[model samples]
Target: MADLAHGKPGAGAALSGGHGAASRRDFLTIAGNAIAAVGAACVAWPFIDSMNPSADVLAAGAPVDIDLSHVQPGQQIVVLWRSRPIFIVNRTPDLLKTLQDTKDISLLSDPDSDVLQQPGYAKNWNRSIQPQYLVLVGICTHLGCIPSFMPQANSVSPGWLGGYFCPCHGSRYDLSGRVYSGVPAPYNLPVPPYRFVSKTVIRIGENPPDGGDFSLDSIEQI
Candidate 1:
């Protein structure tokens, strides 16, 4: 009877050992699946980040488009390209007359436009494809402060003529954005590289190869 009891106890021990081995194998399989899922998420993160816009967009020198349909006459709008502000102005008939009337020629530092200031197509008296549209950089050439637009008629203070006024140093520009002879700024505000993609759309920052440099010199010659 004692020999029979020892044999039954040994059989029970063998069954428990088999069950433990199966449980350990199942645990390892679940752990491996969790690790694989984590690895997949890590790989996907970089692709998601690449889809976002970066500083490279500014460095690439891409052109920006402005819609003129809503741009009111005598008002100006500002847009950014390559970290620079490009100002677009819709001139009233009076503003156009002011540009035409300022004919001293000698008063303008680059009156003949010898310097490369704007694109070729923008060299006209108004500095744009349409007489009412005017595009220029907002930063003052003297010290890089943004000039304030004083568009109201006779807004020019005291002896100053009507135009943009730089509060930093009291520099004055005419309605056509030509700097006064005695101002701190040596040159007129630069006209950025731009083109008219449509009647209502102006593209800034890049000039078309077929269109040429569009610099101030080119426009003056036209």
Candidate 2:
């Protein structure tokens, strides 16, 4: 999630660069904290002391839970899951429309998300389990640079419809992280296994309750 409402809110999430925790004592300390509102464009995630987790939380391969209740609509917050940057956005209704709009889809390389790398609930028009919240691995498929969250229309180029831009190679993606045709990126951004533990709390590095064997390793790229 990037610049929403064309303003930078300096968004922050609960854990920055945490690998995952093997024990609750290390990871559950901030279960009640909300993801601070972040906005504007070209998302830059500098660690904040209040939002950062302790070093022990970096233990690998356990579920990472985040409180997303305070993430304002249109705000995008980035958190590290298994040391991979995860983009979580509270997509507003208007943003949802852009994902569904044909005019916008026409510019994408994979509008239908037909790529097998996107399995489970992500292989759809919106590329998410729900229409409102979007979760994606925030690395550019072209060469692994973090794509800037430019949600403002025309923020990166003429006719831009609010999505991600990988400045490293000029690759573009839609709000749903679908790569654009003629861009250097070939596939949509990968969606990690995640599910809502509660209405506002999201658990990353694990699947939703109904999720069946949707392994992250099955996805060839991050």
Candidate 3:
């Protein structure tokens, strides 16, 4: 994997104290539209002849299906894949604009994604195959702790912008899961290999039909 072109100088220096972690009810309420499920029931295994996949296969990490139909713009939901938290967010038009802005990109540690933090298909500005949907591993890069989904702008700190915040270490990431320049995390959140099975369903753990030579294991981190 390629290293970050811009070396981190003041990493972890911008830690602030203001907001506490979001309550579970608040998270569910925010993601009310984003109903999701995990395991092989969500996948379509072309190679498998059996109608039912064995429990072992699912336990070993079979692709899961995510329903995007209910997810409204600007909302997000979390799903588990291979025992790792997967963040699926529906980005609004205005939110997408923020990601493309030069001013916002300049604040990221690996704005251009020179490093192999995600699949080639997800190396774009939105870090996803589809611009409206963002899929990322929820674990913080600094530590094994999970980051809270503080989507509202400045919810954690002043000028926070909307994104995930790691209360454990104060690491901040953009809505696209890109780590901030001055955070304790060294790399961006990892995007798992996945593709849209339909307009409303996404199959995680499988590469996109149009995407070539991409794999989750090839990422810099999980």
- Model 2 scores worst on lDDT over the 10 consecutive residues at 33-42
Query: By summed lDDT, which 10 consecutive residues of candidate 3 come out lowest?
Result: 10-19
Q: Candidate 3 local accuracy as lDDT?
A: 0.82
Q: Model 3: how large is the Cα RMSD against the reference?
A: 25.2
Tens digits of per-residue lDDT for model 2 on 1-222?
321322445443323324654434334534433232243221445545536665666467577998998889999999988778999998999988888787777777888887755657777878888878899999998888999999998788788879999989999888888999998888889988888888889888778777776866787676
The digit string of per-residue lDDT tens for model 1 on 94-152 reads: 87776665454456666544555666666667666677888888888789888898877
Worst 10-residue lDDT window, candidate 1: 213-222
List pairs with backbone clashes in candidate 2. Answer: 3-40, 7-40, 8-39, 8-40, 9-39, 11-38
Q: Which stretches of candidate 2 lie over 4 Å from their true place?
A: 1-59
Model 2 per-residue lDDT at 130: 80
**TM value for model 1:** 0.65
Evaluate model 1: give its lDDT. Answer: 0.71
